[model samples]
Target chain A: MNAQYRHSQPGYLMILIGVILLVVAAFVWVYGLQPLEIILGAIGIFLLAFGYKLTVEIKNGFLRFWFGLGIFWKKIAIEQIVYCEPFRGVFAGWGIRFVWNGWLYNVSGMKAVTVVLKSGKKIHIGTDEPVQLIEAINSVLHGQVGVESTQMWSEVKADYLKRVEQALSVARHPRSFEILADVGNHLDRRFTELEPRQQTWENFQRIITEMGPPSEYAELVNEDKKSGRLKLTKLEMSAIGVLLVVFGVSAYFYPQMPERIVTQWGFHGQPSSYMPKPVGMFGTPVIFAVLVIALIVIPRTASVSVNIEGFRRFYGGLLIVFSIVMLAVQYQIILWNLGIKTNPNVVGIISVSAIIVWMAFRFYRARRHN
Target chain B: MNLENWQTQLRKGLLDIVVLNLLNRGPSHGYEMVQTMKRIDGLAIREGNIYPVLARLQTDGLVTSYSEPSTDGPPRKYFKLTEAGQKALEDMNKHWDQLISSLESIRKGTGL
Candidate 1:
């Protein structure tokens, strides 16, 4: 009902919506490097927190648009929009998505809506589909043709009043406001969902891929050119990037290539039986590869599953174990190749002792202090 | 695999072509794209991959997105071919074909 101020930068809202997905994904993937998770998660939350804006416009007669990040967006022309209903959520991943024609669309803090488009494509706009918007489209598409300006003005006034009431309500009961704020957030998100009035396949993949993940439900998040998340896709990609870099560097400087592969076992290089296999130290990158693989394989998402955090833990644990194993293997081989005989037990104990102690310290800090 | 070195970039390049060609069929969602990518090859694309190339295309205005609901859940951002994206794919395909021919020549010379 109120006149919503148009935002100058929808990009902010887009980035904000994106970060929320990442934080949720990180919380779920809880299987990677602690420092990396927190570092990335913090950045994500920051962008999202500052990214709220309003800039939905319908330039052509063909579409009605609402845009934002955190929520989902579904478009239906007035003719095709079969019904706009306030209903329970669908697309119930971590949260429920809005709907129209039995399809998932967007999610705000908590509401959902479904719409049937003129083209017969069904869409689930957000539940928080600004009622004022519904009326505008209803009148516009069906032709408010000659509805008195008074009715439109009154509608705008009514919406403004609702916004005012919500603001006052927040001031009165801060805690309840927090809950409502969550609800309001759902609405804010709903706005972002419309960032691209047209969420084509290219758009969806593009945005979601940028989010970085091992999310169990990467598919749930949408990407359409305008903007979205790609955490899980990016994670795999970054790994691929690393692999390419490793191989590329190896190819570029063949001599720098490490002779051994590290895993749960230390510097485990097999002899090619050509020239006393060079006593090369391949420990670091080998361990890095193991860590990368573990993290990527641990599926996660901020949607239905809260896996990022768990995934990080799983991957981190794997990395820690692999690192220790590789370290021992590396040291033992160094001794062997040098013609020095160190007792297996002595080498193993000496190499693993420090890591074991460090891990214990990490455990105590993670559980209690950190 | 000699592919080891250029794999990521090669894969990234291939991703551009795959997404555009698939969208040419009709608008599709992120999941649909990944599944189709798998059907094509030793292509080795993960479910989590290519979302970026889609993003890059969009950033460059070669593609656009819109949401549609499915019986399953949340709205999916459906991708369709944009004129610019289609043109880019055509160019990529030409170069790819030429590159294959050049590599074939190398294979023949080696006579293995």
Candidate 2:
């Protein structure tokens, strides 16, 4: 028994015109046919051959449901369907909407019969007589329990598996095929106990769903590789800020010093070398700023994965040590210009040791969970 | 700590055992098995969710299926547990009992 339902022609007319132009263009280029007449002929052929329509029919004890001039369809073994229900929704403004839930085949109405397949995936046929359609399908489905088609089941499983393997071949993840195979193994074990549907397409879909999208999985894996790397912290930022303030304070004393500033001291604690005042005062901070900025930007631009956690901790610790060294150097230059008798190198050595001791203690305390 | 994610994890953990227990009663197809699982309180097994687990069980030789004529519509592939499956179920039950006892003590706030 076959019953056909056709949606109104207005929706299809727009699509028909769109396809006709492409067909006409192809025909005109290949056969040198006149564009105007070829277009007209194309439209006629399209309407005659593949006009849009929705259909439901009973064939070979299966309720064959399809839509759109037989371009797409699904066949449900009457016994395999548990039930059919009418679904009413916008379904994203409808005319063959492939939404998250399932494929919805509707033209203009809100009413449709949702045919739930035993394996999963639903075929929604939009119809004004949803109740009647449901009754008809149910009547056919409830007629008799016939022999399950093992051969057909095998074919469906084989076809779906092939499609999945093909998609897996070019999937973004390097281990996509392995992941799918593992999932299949898991599924095989679980299904043995559960004894769920033996159908393949829905099973394959479930495997893909569980595994997640290949692109997303690949991105997460990549992110995890980078996540263990280091970054700058609040303590480092505060240390840098304090160093900048000290640099400014030292610069304030620069103008009071001689033109040729004392840069290096001899073993006898005598001024042995001189640089321009600006070089002695500002050179360290300028160099420090450039190095710090480069360090910050290098991580962002580098293609190579950096151990960020280790790098940030090391960088933060080094910044504090280096900042103190810069201040000590600036302090020595100023005191020497002011005629003070002190070894700047000794000042640097003592300050470095003190900072090192302080940092070690702090790190040790932190490690102890204090 | 997303509740839905936690529930999904819990479901995934228990699904294999649930399927095995359902098959222990009698052979049934996938859709029917999902419906039965849904009847249990707090289980939200979707129809699509059961197939891979079934595939996994079959791969492990814990269960087997055969084609049968349905009472109304087309044929159904009905699954039943193998001898290995029965033994596995026993082991699983023992483990489950141990876990339940441990959780019971923890719930009473009397033991680690």
Candidate 3:
């Protein structure tokens, strides 16, 4: 079937001027009046040729719309269109405009029908009889040609799928992947059932939001993996018990020892008067136990995602260093009790310096990695 | 929250029944049907919007299309209601009347 609708008339002023110029040119040519009339006639011909308004027609389910005797034209299948409504965005003002909504083809009047393709782009066709033009388009779309609009729907579906894929690219959590997959399926199922009004930008925005932010989702899903219970190996647990028992049994000698005992020594390898007997004997073991407990508890509570292995290594190093320091203190105290002269200043300085250097190296390496 | 949005939604839902009812009258082309629909006040439908509803109706075997000659242009395609279309129109009209009556009663604070 074929139907035609001419929305705009030809430019009357230009046509009239062209005809006058042609008549004047002919008169001059016949009577040998003036050569300038030839130039005037040529100008009129050019204006008349280009100044006519555009026309639109529907033939065989396709819309054939053109301007000024088909100088500029386009043929669109009506079935690919989703909606056709009257548009009056007058400020867009005239021929072949690219407005924010979409493309506009017009001549003079604000009368136009905006057809939204299934791909979500729009085309505004200027028409004096917008209603009639729309009716014709609707009829073609409802007929056998209507099936082709599914192509447009598929294009829209592809765009949404692409967005979902991008969101999944940075996704860290398996849960986020699952959520996005579900959203993709849901969008596919609901899309065909939606009316034109319901298929707005807001709907897509909502869907994206429902998928959640990729970065935040990743952080949340991996949060639980950051921590685990602080369990010690069987051998390590037995060693801890033995160390604590040995220190406890030695504590019983504090009452029998002299009131004053050497606890610290100066630079020279000579015994130095130190603290009260109890201070030298008990303080070292108490400090060691407290440090060990604090280290174990602190690492266990922290999120494992923020370098759990690093924390474990650091804690183990500190435990070994403190244990060695406690052993030196115990040996010194026992030697003093046996009437031996000894100074721990050299050993103390070396161990402390070694621990400081090791800690500094760990921090420097971490900084480099970051 | 726009009331116009809700109105459009309502119109979209009723469009199928309305198109079938129009075809029940006589065989007419798409443009003619749109023009007739335009006569009703506050019923804003464009010629382009009517096709999908008609296409859907035709798919359901309630309507069919044929070409007809026009006075001043190419032959226009016209839609005719099928046997199923007539039956659907009847049922739709009965349901529409019941709905309208029920809504009217609700508005008047009477029983449905």
Candidate 4:
């Protein structure tokens, strides 16, 4: 097939290196006769066969590339591409290998055109003509060619599109119009594919039935956008309140505490570790504060996508349980410091067992829901 | 739950993988995907429900869409699976196979 654009970059340096390696391997085999010659010869042959050149072509709505006579080839659809831009990165020395979040096809030089796909993966095609390659990709992305927008629809198709719009109206999403257009395009295509006799209102209704209820579309959009923003729920507020209460209790007992306070206990109800009064009394609260901040910030700043809203309740409950556990520990410490006998080991065991059981139950519930 | 409700829940969970498997054959438009899904006896899905699933898939970067001019009507939006989508489908299929085999063993009163 004729491509809209094509470019090839020769790997002169790679060929030179391969030849040198082959010559060295031959010398080693002839003189020293070491088994290491086999490894060197194999690598040399592999490089010469697959690293001689990189060819990139954009044709039939696909970005196709191959290295060294198409032994290793990859094809990406134009529709899958989000955007293409010039890549200016340090010379990492590549020969069809993976980069950060995608693959890099290069024969020589650091200059390349990176195409970011809708899947968030990227393809870096090393090319001497980066500008031309980018232009070719951008033209297709902007719908300048290959794919054209449709302006007209039949009356029957229009009604179907309107119903889809009406159904999706409940979503109130910013991308509603775009989604409507997508559905309209789909209906138009389906209408055209059906036999002329089967293009009646009855057939259209049947098609819509197969599509599912209109409200389902709204639900999907709403669910997909549920994690668009992070907000503190009532449970989270309560968890924070519990943490503050724990801190307040610690403060109440701070003056009565001894300079050295037991912070950790052994399995036999004996104190195993001790800390200064202030550190032992206030350390747990400070750590809890940091943990809370992290819980709030991580979902927002983490590089990977996560649906925090899906388990918002679980997270809030976890925080509350953790705070309560800390509070119990603080109470035990205060009592022990006040000359009241208490088994620190029992408290630790009970707290840990409760947490494990709660977590197991939560996981079971989550599995059932899924 | 009633059998119908149980079946509905099953279909909802399976919808994503089912659509991914269909697209694995080739790129197809929304209507074509819905129609093809209807061919499965117990897996008949509503036509409108497919769009939202497609929308979610596209948002997740698992699937992508492009428009093509049609001779009989307006342009058609066709969806194709991305590499990530293909990988996800493989994993889902593997899990599904394991689930089926485990269930079979349970029914036969073996592999307890």
- Per-candidate TM-score, chain A: 0.28, 0.36, 0.36, 0.40
Please report how far candidate 1 places residue A50 from its true position, in Å.
24
Q: Which candidate is the best by lDDT?
A: 4
Worst 10 residues of 2 chain A by lDDT: A220-229
Give the higher-TM-score candidate: 1 or 3. Answer: 3
Native contacts recovered, in order, as a fraction for each? Answer: 0.00, 0.00, 0.00, 0.52
Order of candidate numbers by TM-score, starting with the best:
4, 2, 3, 1
Off by over 4 Å in 3: A1-227, A233-249, A252-256, A303-307, A360-364, A367-370, B1-112
Winner by TM-score between candidate 2 and candidate 1:
2
Error of 4 at A308 (Å): 24
Error of 3 at A216 (Å): 13
Ranking by DockQ: 4, 2, 1, 3
**Where's the lowest-lDDT run of ten residues in candidate 1 chain A?**
A92-101
How does the DockQ of candidate 4 come out? 0.20
What TM-score do all the candidates reach, one by one? 0.27, 0.31, 0.29, 0.36
Clashes of 3: 6
lDDT of 3 by residue, A1-370 (tens): 3364444545455467667878877765554322234445665565466546667877766777776766556777776665465663545355554442356676655678777655434577777687788767776676444333433444454455445434434432222322332333334434544555565656645544443343433332332222223456343364377458648755766666677776655435445446677777787677777777787677555431222334555566667666665666677676766576555654565455556566556434432321
lDDT score at residue B14, model 3, on the 0-100 scale? 74
Task: Give per-residue CA lDDT, model 1, range B1-112, as digits (tens).
Answer: 6776588557755667777878888888666776677677656575544554554566566788776655433346676778987888789888889888889989898533
Query: Candidate 1 versus the native: TM-score?
Result: 0.27
For residues A25-118, write the lDDT of model 4, one tens digit per residue.
8987655433335546766876787779889999999888887878557778887664566663455366744343345678888788877554
Q: Mind sharing the TM-score for model 4? A: 0.36
